[model samples]
Target: MKSQIRVVWALMWSRAAVLRSDPERGEITTTVIVTALMAIAAIAIIGIIVAKLTQKANSIDLG
Candidate 1:
């Protein structure tokens, strides 16, 4: 059982090394940047909507 565990670990290590050396890793960076930009845009849009709603609410005459 111990030998089997060692073999499994070795295989996993080698696979990780191969992935680390891959040339296409930049794709992950691009995906992260795009996701961050989208998140920022969504936050900005929600902020603008909330500001407009608050302004309209405060403009009402309570007297």
Candidate 2:
């Protein structure tokens, strides 16, 4: 089990090192910006959904 973990860790470290060494700006920058925009959109949508649900729940007549 320990050996398997070590092998996986080593592989991850090698890939990280490769990314760090290569400074390709275009793809990485575009990817980061798109990811951030998508995250913000998701949060806004979730907030709207929660607000709508709360409003509807409060309007219910549960006597």
Q: Which candidate is the best by lDDT?
A: 1
Residues 1-63, model 2: lDDT tens digits: 999999999999999898888878468789999999999999999999999999999999999
Off by over 4 Å in 1: 1-23
Model 1: lDDT to the true structure: 0.98
Q: Judge candidate 1 at residue 40 and give its lDDT.
A: 100
Cα shift from native, residue 48, model 1 (Å):
0.3
State residue 4's C-alpha deviation in candidate 1, in Å: 26
Predictions in order: lDDT = 0.98, 0.94
Clashes of 2: 0
- Candidate 1: RMSD over Cα atoms? 3.2
Local error of candidate 2 at 13, Å?
27
